[model samples]
Each structure stands twice: as structure tokens, then as C-alpha cells.
Target: MPTSQIAPFRLLRWFAGLSAIVIVLIAWANAWVVSSFLADHLFQREAAVSRDFVQNVLVSDGSINYLTHPDDPELQRSFYKSIEHLSKMHDVLRTNVYGRDKLMLWSTTQSLVGQRFDDNDELVDALQNELVVHAGRITPEIRPKDEYAGLSPRANYFMEIYIPVTLPGTGEVVGVVELYKAPLALTQAVQEGDREVAVAAVVGALALFLSLFWLVRRADRTMREQHTQLLEAETMAAIGELASSVAHNIRNPLASIRSAAELSLESPEDHGAESARDIIGDVDRISARITELLRLSRTGASAIQPTDMVALLQDCVADHQNTFRRRQQELVLDSQVTQAVCTVDAHLLQQVLHSVLANASEAMPDGKRCQIRVSEASRKTVRIEVSDSGAGITPEVLKDVFRPFFTTKPQGLGLGLPLAKRIVEGFGGQMTIDSQPGVGTTVRIDLPKA
Candidate 1:
């Protein structure tokens, strides 16, 4: 496909990809927050249950004295019985009781008793009378010892909780209780929360994407319609300009021919030949104007040839020398570059040059000087300048000098400069004019070198 046709699709793809990534990131973040909150809630519930069991059942009747003296066979047997019953009821995997020095004083896993856990963050928090919960895979450092290691179906994915044991009435933390349990229920709750968050995010993001896509498509369609209307308007305007130019150019010559015929009819004895010549001249002028219009209407069908610039300019100047003499204008030709050659339609370029010289001469009808300068503008282009010192043009009038059917002179058709500019441009050249109110006007034409 063309790039213009594919650009919008590429843009949409980029927007969709970026939006999808952003939505997924946002959803993942929300899911993580929900899961953390759900997991924490479950862990706190388990910790609370463990705290109640410790306070009401295990240490209710001054069992702390028995825990402090674990060497007593009677107290140890009683403690083991209570722990075993609680473990069976709660489905807890392992339990440990830590004393003030963070040393394990009792455990359902008997082998873990008497071990110290000084560096555990959860143990530290419990010693400060705070409950803490940790979830996820078991680390080698804190895994249970001996046969208790593989007691749960998925022993690795377990919850480790710490609950502080406070003294009744004193509210002082004297010991910490650590509990390990399977996290199957907690995982199910967190997954449910994550699923809810994911659904909400997907729905919201999709709605937003669809809304934006529809708006852009609507705007694109509106722009395309506006563009088509603008092109039609421009085509109509061009046709109007051509019609206006034709009428303006033909009106003057037809009026001149009509006047000559009337004069010849009224006085045929003395002015017969002169009136016939005047009619013929008017007819020729009309024919030339029609030819100019046809040339402007045609596309690039004219053959381009390399022409000697110096010889061409001399011939154009010679043809207009008689008009310059009648106006008493001094015409100066300034050629700086030797062997200046360019590719152009020689006849069309000569006509353009003649029009410019005629305009300059008309601007200075009282015999002021006009200069034509020819030089190499660059290695690839040649420049020609026609400058005249006259009652120069005002900035306001100069602005419309190139508009068709706009004229400063009462009898002017105003097609000369515009047609000249068009002809030059058609040959891959440019024409420009500079004028000052008191300093006169200069027209420059730049054409590519052959």
C-alpha cells in the first residue's frame, strides 16, 4: 500500500499497542495491591485465632510457668497434648514458642525446640508486641526440620505468622508465637480479587480505546470531505480567471477594429488605406492575444532547445529599438558572463522578454533610461534583470500587478506580467519583481543553465 494510505493504520497500531501495555501495567499493579490486601487480611485472621488459642487455652491457668520449666515431665506432657489438639483442629503445619531471648522454648515439631532465631524480622516485630505475616515459597533458612518438612501437600507454599504473647493485665510481651500453615485458602481469595480487578480494567480500557478510535475516524472523514470541496472550489476559480482574461483581452481589439471600420465608412476618400491597415493591425493584435491564451492553456508540449543567450537578447532588443526610439528611452544591455547558454522554448522566452521591455518602456514614456542585465546567477542558473527609472509603483498597486485582469493603466488588460511569469515557470524558471515608490522597479528572471 502507499504510505499515505497506510499511515493511519500504523498510527492506530502504535496507539493500541501502547494503550494495551499501559492498561496491562495498570491492571497488574491493581491486582498486586488487591492480592497483597487479601493475603494480609487472611494472615491477620489466622494470627488472631492463634493469639486467642495461646491466651485462653494454653496460658489461661498460669501455663507460662510450665512453659518456662520445660524440663518438668508432667508440664511438658500437658503442653504437648494442648499443642497437638490445636494443630489438628486448625490444620496448622508447625508451631514454635519463643522466649524473651528469642530462643524456641516449645514447638509442635519437637526437634525445633531450643533453636534460636535472633535475625528473623517477624520474630523482632513480635517481640515488640506486633503481629506480622509472611507468605510465599519457603526459604531454606526457615524450612522446618526432619519429618515435618514435607507434612503439607504443597509444603513450599506456606504462610508464616508471628503473634506476640502478652501477659494478662500487664499487657507486656513476654514471648512470641510463630505459626506455619498452608496458603491454599488465602491463594484462592487473592486470585478472586485479582480476577475482579483484571475484568474491570479490561472493560474500562476497551471502552476508552473504542471512544478515541471513533472520534479520530470521524475527524478523518470530515477532513477528507473538506479537502474534496476545497479542490472543487479551486478548479472553479481557475476557470473563472481564464474566462475573465479572455474577455478582457478580446474587448479592446474588437473595439479598435469597430472604430476603424466606422472611420473608413465615413471618410473613404482620404483615409481608406490607413483605416484598412488599422483594422488589419487590430485583427492581428486579436489573433496574438488568442494565441497567448492558447499557449497558457497548454501543458509542457513545446520542445526545449539550447539557445545562445547573448544573441537572443540582442535580437529581442533590436526588435523593440524602434519603440524605444519613439519613446526616446535609452536602452542599456549589460552582459557580464561570456558564453551564457540555457535550455528553453526560444520563441516563448523571446515573447516574455519583449513584454517586460515594453512594460519598462511604458513605465518611462518620457525618455528615461532602462537597463537589461544578464549574468550567471549560479553554476546551474542564469539571471536576467530589466530595471527602469520611472514614476515607480506604489506598494498597494504592486501587490496586485501579477493578478489576471488587474491593471494600473486605463487601457491595460493586465495579463502581460502574469502570462510572462507563467511562461517562465513552465520552463522550470522563476520570475520576481522589486519596486519602490520613488526608486523605480526591477524585474528579475532566473532560468536554469543548459
Candidate 2:
């Protein structure tokens, strides 16, 4: 069944969209939080300033004289003169001074003076030795068109504070001082701070988003690479099955040909004997090739076992003796470890070593030497090095050496290096090659120690 796939980069696009939404939400939350914090802060600060201002301005000239002589013309004149000017300050919208009995002693509004209001919650709280503060604002959208007609936004913003006035030089309960002010400085400060908090929130969120975006993008790239490798692996597996079947079918006829050649070689007619020997060699080579194909076809199912790598390396060298002699190549084994053990499928490991040896031998068509070395790579790993003293591969060819079906030899199936690499990786090992054009080539494999 065919399945549809989303276009590439869809994940990134989705992430960008989601991040933008998240940042916007963060901005709103920051604005609301900052606004509430600033409001509470301003209330506390303004309450303190109002209580102190009223206390000082009221008693700086005289003390209890006004509280007892509210109707006395002389003291009234003094009290009126002392506080009347404060109400006219730019931010002060109105001011009311209440006596201890809750009678309004003085106010910015002349008519409100001497009036008693018992039901005002803020005023009642103030009379109880507590300060009360309330803030209200009318935006243009909610303004009463006729009542708040000519009011500026600054005028629309107001703070009402009811403070308990304490007697000078003592904590005596005196009266309540109420101030309703526009609080221009506080209003503007809050607006500016809210903006800054929102900006900071967005900047921080974007930084986090970008960091996450980069990591996800890298993961997506890795996933794509793995997907490509999976497709190649599936294709190779299909081809391997077909090649195995062909190799199996050819083995019977190939064996019959080898038996006939062997019988003819015993005829002892010189030329016929020589030809039979050559035919027999060709048949044996073909049989070996078929065996390699069959081995590769059985690849993914290799059984794993704890193996002594030193012994395995020695066996690999011994097994390649016939190929070494036939190809006019010398094989040498060097080990720094007597027994480096690892967990791997023994047959697969042998197949890989054989492939490496054969490639190394074939590199020096005119005859050369190949070396295999086993040593401890680290406390937890064993390293195997296969070096060939043949004219090395070119940089262009070297890069593609492990690609499936890529080879320099006419008869090469091109699966050797790639298969070797796959098998090594399945054994929890890594394989790499280093080649210098005129010097030589070396293949390194590192596996975890058992």
C-alpha cells in the first residue's frame, strides 16, 4: 500500500507557528502579572507617603489646637491655610480631612466639609487605624461620553487613599485623611514597566524556542539519513536473496565440472594435463565466489558467541593461505594482546576478515604483503588493524569504497567492504579505512571487549 507523506520542513513550520503562539501567551501573562504587581506596589508606597504627608502638614505649625477648636474662626483660618494649598497640586484631584468622630472637618469641596459619612468602607477602615487604597481607571472605550468628556487618559486614572492620621510625637488616633489623586507618575511607570516585562518574556521564550528548534532540526536530519539507509538495506536484501538462489543452482554443475577436470588432469597427456589443471583452478575460484555469495545471503542471521579475537585473527590468516599463495601475496599477523575476547558472531567476523584480506591481496596485483594486527584500543575495547603494502586507493575512490556495489575490480561484487562494515556494526563495533594514494591502505575495526 502506498502512503502519503507530509512535505519536508513541515515539522519546522509547525514548530515556528507553535512557538509564536506560546510567546504571545507568555507576553499576555507577563503584562497581567506586571500590572498587578505594580498596582499593589504603588498602593503600598502611596499609602505611606499620604499618611506621612498629611501627618506632617497638619501638625508642623500647631498640634491638637485644630481638633478641639473646629469651629473657632482663628484656628479654622490656620487649618484652612495650612491644607488648602495641597489640594491644588497637579496630581491631587481632591482631599478630605475627617475628625475623630467621623465628621468631615475640611475638604477640597466646600459643600462636603462638616458632612458625616458612616457607610464608606474605605473611610470606616481608615477610622479603625488601617489605611485603605483603591485604584480606578476609565479607558476611552468605557468612558461615559458626557461625564468624562474632556478627561485625558491621565485624568481618567485615579487613586483613592484613606489613611489613619496619627498625632505628632505620639501614636494617638486622631482622624482620617482621604486623598484622591490622578497618580500620573505611577500610571506611566506601570505602563512602561509592563512593556519591558513583556519584551523580556518574549525575548527569553524566543531564545528557548530557537534552541529547541535547532535540536529538533538536527534530529530530523538524522532521521532522514537513517531512512535513506533503510531503503538501501531493503534493496540489498532483495538482491541478496536472488544472488543466493543463483549461486546454489550453479554449485552442482560447477562441482561436476571440477570432478571432470580432476579426472582429465590424471590423463597425463602433458598439454591436456596443464589445461585440466588451469580449468580446475578456475572452477575452484568460481566455487569460492559462490560460497562467499551464499555466506553473505545468510548474513543477518549469524549467531553470536563470546570469541577470543587473537585466536580468530590467527585462524583468519591460516584460512587465507591458499589465496595468498595463488595471488602471489604474503600474509603476516602481529598481536600485542595474547587473547583479546569480544562478543560477536564468529562466522561473520571471519567473513569480514577474509574479505579484508582478499581486497588487500588483490590491491598488489604484481605481488605485495598484507599485515593484520590486534591490540587493546582502550580499557573496554579491542582494535584490529589490517594494512596492505600495495599502491593505495585514490581519494575519489576511497570515499566510495564502502558504498554497496562500488568497486575498482572487474570481477568485484562491490559488497565486501559494505558487508564487512555492516557486520562489524552489528557486533557493536566501528570500522573505518585510511588510505594514502602512493603509500598504502589500512582498515581499522574497534569492538567492545567482553
Q: Report the lDDT tens digits of candidate 2 across residue range 52-86.
A: 87778777877336776677888778877767766
Error of 1 at 352 (Å): 41
| lDDT assessment of candidate 1 | 0.75
Off by over 4 Å in 1: 1-13, 59-76, 137-157, 250-450
Q: How accurate is candidate 2 locally (lDDT)?
A: 0.81
TM-score of 1: 0.48
Judging by TM-score against the true structure, name the best candidate.
Answer: 2
Model 1: which ten-residue window has the lowest total lDDT?
147-156
- Model 1, residue 143: displacement in angstroms? 12
